[model samples]
Target: MRRTTTVWMTGGLGLIAAGVLGMLRDNLVGSAGAPVIAAAAEILAAAALLLFAIGTSRESSVVARRPLGVIALVVLALWPFATQFIGRLLSPSEPIGDLAWSVFGVASVLVPAAAGFIAAVQIARADTVPSPWNRAPLWVFGLHVVAWVVPQLLFAAVGADDIQGLAGLFLTLGKLAYLAGTLGLGIVAVLLANRRRTTTVPVFQSASTDRD
Candidate 1:
């Protein structure tokens, strides 16, 4: 396989592993090794995001040609660290920290959602990837929105009684959606990598034939 293809496959696997580890960490909270699992998940997710950014930027897809799409991918890749690590470390009671947390919280939701929407639209319009695979980004965006909104709606509807159980159930569902979305992204990346390899072979052969 080509080096590019290997990168895509490795990144895809990393995403899958990160999702699995994240779920495991959630389930194992307060357990002996929960912190370790959480750290592993965070590291894997960051690595996967970087790899994906590299893969998308190098690929010949229509999305890669669009400046907005590239910017969105880069922003999405970096936003997690800001929200997950740096923001979390800040004390919410302090003025500067409070402002930072507010910015992080809003940006965490809006920025990613906007970025995903932009990327999804570009992916949907692109003909480089095959039918459903091309629409994978759209699904990721849609599911992500659902994951964020549904839990809140459920909480609003059900009220505070039995909050723990209801919250846990919806949160798990949200996590499942997130997992599915990540899995979809991984599949799409692999598909795109294969598609790139397949398309390039014909051009090379055609070039060789013309010289013969």
Candidate 2:
């Protein structure tokens, strides 16, 4: 019912679908077509998040805003990182710029991820807020960080040469992490979307209307 819930639910589901696609590459689907499906899913998820970030302000009704506002903005910024890699996948030889750029850029996701953590805490600390952020659940964002964001950061840091004998081991872990994060986000979103909140009518207003 709530816009926040709707958007978050969609964002979460998108992430989960993307994660499933990411894993299919190694399964019966085989490596060739699976990577393409995964890439498409990732792009779709990223694009959805980017669009959802734009909705935060509109959903909040252009208010003075809160920390979640910045969180949305940062999340919007984070999606572009995926596009760069996606571009590389589509055209590897075209040079998507330095890999170092990707490493550092991907790390920026930590900013919003941290912000989301703080926002979730803030919600827990306070009460009686308006829409756009009120009653929004965010533990899933942390899951996303643990599952995908952390792995990306580590992947960037641990080059092929650095892994040496542990390449396959870490690579598999990295892939698993992404899948977990995406699915976690999706589940959280769906839970939030279906959540129910009790609304109480003002006693005075009810009495006044009855009296009339």
Clashing pairs for predicted structure model 2, backbone only: 12-186
- lDDT per residue as tens, model 2, 36-153: 7856776766654554444454542111234565365445445456546655555434475567457545565555566556545544434323444443435445445556554456
TM-scores for every predicted model: 0.75, 0.50
Full-model lDDT, candidate 2: 0.53
Most accurate candidate by TM-score: 1
Off by over 4 Å in 1: 1-4, 56-62, 93-100, 191-212
Assess the local accuracy of residue 146 in candidate 2 as a C-alpha lDDT between 0 and 100. Answer: 55
Local error of candidate 1 at residue 99 (angstroms) = 5.2
Alpha carbon lDDT at 20, candidate 1: 84
lDDT of 1: 0.71
Global fold similarity of model 2 (TM-score)? 0.50
Model 2 regions more than 4 Å off: 28-30, 56-165, 197-212
